[model samples]
Target: MTVISIPGSKSVTARALFLAAAANGSSTLLRPLSSDDSEGFAAGLTGLGYEVVREPDRWYLTGRPCGPAAGEADIYCRDGATTARFLPALAAAGHGSYRFDASAQMRRRPLAPLTEALRTLGVDLRHEDAEGHHPLRIEAAGIKGGELTLDAGESSQYLTALLMLGPLTREGLRITVTDLVSAPYIEITLAMMRSFGVEVTRGGPGNTVFTVPPGGYRATTYAIEPDASTASYFFAAAALTGSEVTVPGLGQGALQGDLRFVDVLRRMGAEVHTTADATTVRSTGGLTGITVNMRDISDTMPTLAGIAPFASGPVRIEDVGNTRVKECDRLEACARNLRRMGITVATGPDWIEITPGTPRPTEVETHGDHRIVMSFAVTALRTPGITYDDPGCVRKTFPGFHEAFAGFAEILDRRGPATRP
Candidate 1:
């Protein structure tokens, strides 16, 4: 088994950057992710008058506890959904005037839920391009910070953004989350806030009511874990192929909830192990399909769905309608791409059913979404001759994914790079 050192968590790094930016003093992030998304996040902070210094293996940033120094700033979010979603709340909390822009495709994504929530919080956010989507113009007067009703069914990022601003509110905040999806991410958000020195009062994944008293975050040095979402590719590779892969710096106690993707693999009869310092995945033989609802760990839906065609039975994934609003319509994208490769995929509004088939050689349309590229690459491990379009989109979260996955291929002594034409 090759022990791979995965990069730091994109989710954690993004959240950490904002928390550090709003902290009372300087906070150092040890082993933070270096990618387009995190870079965009740091750059967004820099534009808001926070100091961000990048060094080998770490990042150091100073807080803007008094809110952004600039009265106006432009944020180039590119394709980072986290950066796009989270920063708006930060802007509202800081009372900074800002304009956020993204890639052409990202402009089509729905931001109305969060934007509307911000409006409810008394932050003036308008759609500068089209109505109800990015690019948005934020004329921040700071949050009114009372009870706000939010629909997180579209994205937990909406709740995450608001939850992050809970402590910064003048009168604090009471959030009522309805139709919440990706609930585990809320847990990660609360945990990270606790590390930065504030506790978010979690009401329920059952009945989602959250209370945040007006207590601000303190500056603290933090260490980020390896990206568990990215790790799912390797885990799925192990399940699809009869080989073993281990990711160091991730384990049972990791902060990222996407680590639960391994639990799905284990359920599918993959050999999975977790110790204090590392997690390992090794194939037993072939996978047996089971129905899965991916709302909590929905990021791995494509990854798991990629490998399902080779399973013994039908694999059903559900409760991820939010995927439709991601970097692309991931549910539809997976069905289209998998069917492109001669696999049988039945897709519904919020679920997909993939049955066993001999996957044929074909090109995967990534729709410029990184998860699409990475997920299909896992399928390529078992079913060869899979080439993907817009492979560079992995830069959004995992910039070195091609290089790392190439090493993954070499370690297993498998076929050539998934990028080969």
Candidate 2:
């Protein structure tokens, strides 16, 4: 079995950056992700006048609990929603005037819900470009938190942004979410908050009330775990090509909710073994397809779709319409990219069904989404000469994805200058 270790969780990295930026003292984070998304987040913190140091796999952030530096500045979030969403709220909490903008894809993603909620909290923010899109001009003169209703049906990152910054408000914050999706991400938020000594009370399912104490975040050293979403690609690779793959640093009891992907692998007829710190997966028999609802774990949709073509029956993925607002329209990208490989796939607004067919080798376009890049790379194990446009996009989440793939698979022409899709 080929063993591989993925980087720390992007979810964890973004949250830890926010915690460190807002903490009372300097905080050092180990094994943080160094992808484009994370880089943009770190840049945003630095642009706001916080001192940040980046190493090979660690980050040192000196907190500015009082707020970012004086003066209005433009903080470009690129296409990083975690940076775009969380940084604005953090800046607003500390009373600063800043303008936030992103790439075209991020501009299309909605930010109104979070902005409106912040407005309800007495922070002044005006949309510079589109009514509900990016290029947001935030005039932060401090905020008084109150109860607010948020429509999180489009993206859970909106609610998570609010939840993360809610404690910094004067009154604390109570969020009543309507049609909240990607619920597992919320669990990650709560868990990370508790790690930093912040407490939040869960009213019930889909209802949460947050109470940020008078004192702000306390500085603490945190070790980030391996990303389960990134691990899914290798597990899918093993299942698709009859190879034995062991992903170290990920246990069955992993904190990431996406760790349930191993169960999905088993459901597709793969043998999975779990240890205290790793999960090994291998194809047991001929793979049989099954239908699955991936609401809580939508991040795995692309990997599941990429592996579906190797199954004996049709693989159906359901309850992931919210993926449309992610870095890319994941459902549509999965279906379109699989079709590029001459696979028979069907897609709806919220579901996808793929039937195995004569797989043909073709270059896949990632739409600059890391999951799309990794998902299609798994298909290369079974196909011949499959190249990915902008393969470097995987650095957005997994900086070592190409090197990791080269360990077990034959990677052709990866050293040349990266090609944009």
Candidate 3:
């Protein structure tokens, strides 16, 4: 078995930065991801006058329960949705005039759901350019949180931002979510908030209402887990190449919902086993196609789509319409790239179906999306000459992805087909 060490979870690192920044004292994060998204989140905190010290494997953040120390500041959120969404909520709970902007790509993504909810809570937020988009300003006089309704259908980061803001408010917050997607990501936020010493209550019909009490947060030493989304590429590679890949630090007790991508692989004839501290995937000498609903784990949809052409039947991924609004239209990007490689593919508003066939060598148009680059790398295992138009776009999450995957591919080439015990 080839054991691969992946980077820390970008989602976890972003949330921990927010929690640590709001806690009562300094917090230490062990093994935090040092990627563009995570670095952008930390940089935003620093711009807001929160102290952050970075080292090789750990990060130190000094909490400011009262909000940012800077009376005024401008924060550039880069391309990180977490930084763009959560930092403004953090700033809104403070007394200051803050301006927030992002890259053109991020500026094009939707910010209405979160911004509208903040506005409903009496936040003085204004869009300097396009409505429901970035380049916005916030005149913060502190938030007095109360009951409100939110629709998180397009993105769950909207709800996550508010949930993380609950303790920083005056009277706490009661959010009744009308519709939600990526529900497991909300669970990650709640788990991390509890680790920072705040317990949020979830009780309503189908747990639709979230009640978070005031009192801010208490800092604690936290350890970030490996990114399950990043690991999906290697797992998919194993499924495609008849190799065994073992990723430590992710197992049955892992918090990320993306880890369930292995369940999808299992259904497609890969052998998947999870232990307390690790998970392993080994192909069973073949691939079988199946239809799956990937709404909760939509991040791995591209990884599945990348390997779909090698399956024995049609591979259909459904219920992931939100993917259209990500860094790019991921559903269409996957279909386009697969078709570029001489594979048959069909797409609708929320689904894509791929017919099994041998893929021809072709350059993948990455659309500057990291998932697209990494997912297609799995396809490159069988179909060589698979270059990416913008391979460096992976810096947003995993800067060392190319080197890591190249090494894993070398190991698979030497080991040949994996044997079952």
lDDT of every predicted structure (CA atoms):
0.85, 0.82, 0.94
Once model 2 is optimally superposed onto the true structure by TM-score, how far is the C-alpha of residue 404 displaced, in angstroms? 2.0
Best by lDDT: 3
Ten contiguous residues minimizing lDDT sum, candidate 1: 412-421
Give a tens-digit lDDT track for model 1, residues 1-421: 7688788999999999988987888999999999988998888888877899999788998887667878899988888888889887887887668999988887888888888888887888789878888888989876658998888888888888888888877888898887788888888888999998887776766658998877678999999999999999988887777777899888878887788898898998888889998999887547888899898899999998888887889999998888988888999999998888888889899999998887887888999999999998887776668888688989888888988887787776653322210
- Which candidate, 1 or 2, would have the higher lDDT against the true structure? 1
Model 3 C-alpha RMSD vs. true structure (Å) is: 1.7
Pairwise lDDT winner, candidates 2 and 3: 3
Tens digit of per-residue lDDT, candidate 2, span 33-56: 878888899999999988999998
In model 2, the clashing pairs are none
Model 2 gets an lDDT of 0.82
**Whole-model lDDT, candidate 1?**
0.85
Q: Candidates 1 and 2: which is better by TM-score? A: 1
Clashes of each: 0, 0, 0
- Model 2: residues >4 Å from true position, as ranges? 204-214, 410-421
TM-score of 2: 0.93
Looking at model 2, residue 64 earns an lDDT score of 70
TM-score order of candidates, top first: 3, 1, 2
